[model samples]
Target: MPYENPAALRITSPGLCRDATFSSKHALHLLSWNIAGWSAKQKNLDLIAHLNKSDIIFVQEMWSTQNLTLDGFSITCLPATPSLPKSKGRPKGGLALLISTSTSARIKSLSSCNNIAMGVLLSYNTISFLLINVYIPPYSSRVLTDQAWEDLDRYITDLEAQSPRALLIIMGDFNARIGPNNDALFASNLWGGEVIDHYSSIYGRISKDSRINYGGICLTRLIGSRNLIMLNGLNQVDPCAEYTYISGQGSSVIDYALISQHLLKTILKFTVGNRQDSDHLPLTLSICLPERGRLTFAHNQMANPLHYTHKRTFWSPLVASNVALFLTSPSGLAIKEKITNATNPFSVLTDYDTLISKLKMSLMLPSPSHRAINRTGLPRWFDKDCLDVKRQLRQTYLHYRLQNANTLPPEYFIIKKKYKSMIVTKKRQAVHEGWKALIHASRTKNSKSFWELVSGSMRPSNLAPCHISSHT
Candidate 1:
């Protein structure tokens, strides 16, 4: 059965999932990777570790693998539509999105064209955006015809037309190489001249080795028409200058993340991962989102006998007075006569639904407090002294970086070493103090205090310890 509620569709981690709330101060980390049919059993742990850092992830070519679940993520997979034509002996293409459990983002599935593409409307607080993940099949004279390209272009155009105000973010393996020189805004030093020429020669040049092939031309035109910014092209220097995809034919940059112009200022960083787990490396982006106010309600204590008694006592007198007033009213004469003349217990009883409605209308329950308790138990070592030291450390590091550019001064490293040592010493001291207090409490036979100390000393787990056996 289809879920009627959007929240009902969500699956939470079994244990130790953080209470996710929207915050404007922090940046949202997004990652996209073409895993090239992630089927290696041995690399599962490595892949999970890499994905843990990002809040949202888009993976392409996730072929043939089911039951691929992570500890702190909700996974949604879309496999290639069988109706689409496939090449003989070619592996089926698939895509997946892994959203962090510790995110306040609400996601609703949007209409998409089969498995070639998937779209989702994401809302975080007041901000809403449309994210489309697409995997354009490699151009082939025999297998992928012009019809495929036409379908993809049409889909994109329709998506834009539907949500004109939405901040659009299109990320995937486009199978299109957009050379640095094609967009004059990109500096020459960003990409090597030889690399551009090599791709141009292989793919056929459109305009002097700067733009290549029909795919590249289509993508460039799309970017221009949409007023979108190519994150890779905006790079001043290529952090990962090596090609994204490597094969017998050689390397090329086929993966891309094109976002709306409004998001350019919010971009904190962009980089391509150097991990060799797949032929294509991961592309990571960090962007700051608008801040939102956190709302939390105090835990309801109505289940407790003492709490129930207190509530009953507080409302009983008021309820009795209201009931008496109702009985004396002119309209209440019919009800009063009916109650007085009732023979059976059932005759005297009011309808359960109507009784509840009346009680709710007459009775006023206390509102739950909005103030949230601080659950993060910082160690005693994290005191004002430690805070002062941290401030000094930050200032020193910033000063050194500003003066020396990318190079760290020798004094900065010396101070960093000293800072690390100080933290270690303070932490050890705090541990010793905690142990001493625990021992004293135990010796004194203060059971409540001992238990409190023990519970307080324990650290909160961030990930579920056990693995989920079922995927669906």
Candidate 2:
């Protein structure tokens, strides 16, 4: 159970992951992460900044008693009611939801369940969604607790009872080890009503674990009855069903994203953060709303979360000596052309960070290039076969680790090496074809396809709003 460093887990531009592409403008992004303890420290702040691309963020275990604040977001924090006799210290069992203010999103009702779950109705863009964040207490599968089983059912009932019905988006750390999607695991009459397929429609989802716990059993049955799909392993995009929490005790995918089948189309890809500043990883679901989706934006250019973004400077050693010297010098760090922090080029300015941003754009805008590069997260050439292999590799790897054997079974290496080699060969052929297409496009003066492929390969698509100018 080796813990992967959060830094090594950071997802960067292009290349590997199939779901690392897409824009936030045409899509709604929901990110769920357990921060353990929320604070104002630099690492937490940096983590928050990195996650700013998400439109809706659900956080669990806030562990804070005071109200929390974040720019560009409307935050709601819910802390479990403590015992009457011991209510004087640090608050425990906290949950939070952060919605981007840019959306015409309004919170209608705030409610909770079994002191372990809470939800709010979100109305925006003419669509209504009941958003629930849950943090279930640990309970043994052998001795399932009544509270753990009934909390969600009761909460959903109360929230759905609101005047108009809304779609459901429930997510959080359930501490449930639902190994995989097995029809046998669920009782035939789990919910009294027969649900066709029992599993909601999901393109690619796979779970690696085979260990089903008390919470997992309850959750599986509950979602089965309600027609909600658990968006994690047991599928393709995240085939290995990456473990959310890892430790000496071993790892499992305890945290999850539960959503109604209706919201499936808009989601180009579903991803789980490989690392974060917590024991659990982050899960992000990107939903592409229609282009005409009613999103509120300030007339002020700066107020738009879209239309602009900050890209880190990529230092280059190939540039001319004089040009490189100036770029590396104290003066280059200043947007107002005044040298202040040569030690830190990323220092924020007080036009509340806007004035300096404009000045920097004016000073360092890139050379002109083609436009029309829409990042849709789907790789045009990556077909279903490639996806299947990735799914298998991940599942196998997880199984190997969990076995905890000193030596792999016979023929394991031979099979592993064969699969790896096949993937490498396929990757090389794909890259060659891509470059060939790029060259042909350039030769034929077909700029649209050329830039699309180029930009797609160069950087991962950001959820932040961005626009390319006519000048560049």
Candidate 3:
């Protein structure tokens, strides 16, 4: 009646619905938000609204916040470390994990570092999970930059070592861009890219850096090798293409959710929530995990027909029926491209020439491959040469992300324009009709067909492998 505990509440709105899709498989909606220090009242109200929109929330930058509670809901907060000897006071922020009390996940072990790194080993029925909250220091520099990633990497490795057989969900303000680190330890520094490139570059160097080199043990390298989900934002539909830092000259995603391999197929949709509050926009994902146990989504012999059915049909846009039918599919890259581009402020005057330039530059490679560095006379301890390569790769990706973010035409502004010639919002009526069809399918048991429909919307190109965990 009175909103259970405002600090902890369970939302039962249709919008906040959850169900076990398969006998053992269930759907979990995980939401991450940087609330930007909302007032306790505002935080409570917002938590209600957010819970209405999501199943669980990972909140950050909630300093001086009021106690939160809600009916049928449970919350675990990693409070700011108390009384530090100046040198070790850590940061002032913390993270909170809110879950439905109706659900079975209970914290088995919980701990938080001063910088807001919290881990909770949770058990739901027979399934187990390790959920971690981390907020690495942003504003890149040489020493601190590498240290942050190393810390995160070590933390994850430690978790993995502890629970080798559990599902993992690591989320928060990573502060580090998926893009670059600025140090010269990386190849990008040798070639010239952003400081963030240093992360990859330094790790590369560490692999080969003869001194203090872990030799292929760097966190960035580990992320790539492990098959963890990186949630790419460069391409369309990676909702993160939009700028999260509203006021910065530079904008690329620093917030993310890295899930383990076991949950990859279960990822229903990864979306960026457009809420105004923190410098970082909220990231939302809907995952369909096994309710009872794992069930194969595809038959062993069905094979991937599309992998062999490769024809370059991406040039032609979707037909009216297809558009109507495919709009709701989670894999509709083109639909996202069309809708976001049409409604975005960046798409207006999107100079094709400029896009081409950015794309090319974004794809450029640094000299001396990671493999090459292993052979070169470069010091092995630091693998500084490999760092160079990492820097180059990150810079290339960052370049594209920045370009894409800038080209995004503001949605509100686009609707206001009355151009002399009709600006085709990609045949809006056709798309709307398609959306209707998608909605209908979603209501039935045929929603699985959505992927098949949307899969045809994008052309197949070899993008870099996403940072998913390599081993289960």
* Number of backbone-clashing residue pairs for each candidate, in the order shown: 1, 13, 69
Model 3 alpha-carbon drift over 4 Å, by segment:
1-25, 38-47, 65-71, 81-91, 180-187, 190-219, 234-240, 248-250, 293-472
How close is every model to the real structure, measured as TM-score? 0.50, 0.55, 0.48
Q: Residue 51 lDDT in model 1?
A: 81
lDDT string for model 2 (177-287, tens) is 765545433433433464535343222334655566666767766776776766685233355466677443556778988877666434556776744245577888876
Where model 1 places Cα greater than 4 Å from the true spot, the runs are: 1-24, 41-43, 65-68, 81-90, 142-146, 183-211, 237-242, 293-472
lDDT of each candidate versus the true structure? 0.56, 0.59, 0.48
TM-score for model 1?
0.50
Pick by TM-score: 1 or 2, better one: 2
Q: lDDT tens digits, residues 196-215, model 3?
A: 32233111100111111222
Worst 10 residues of 2 by lDDT: 1-10
Residue pairs that clash (backbone atoms under 3 angstroms), model 1: 24-291
Ranking by TM-score: 2, 1, 3
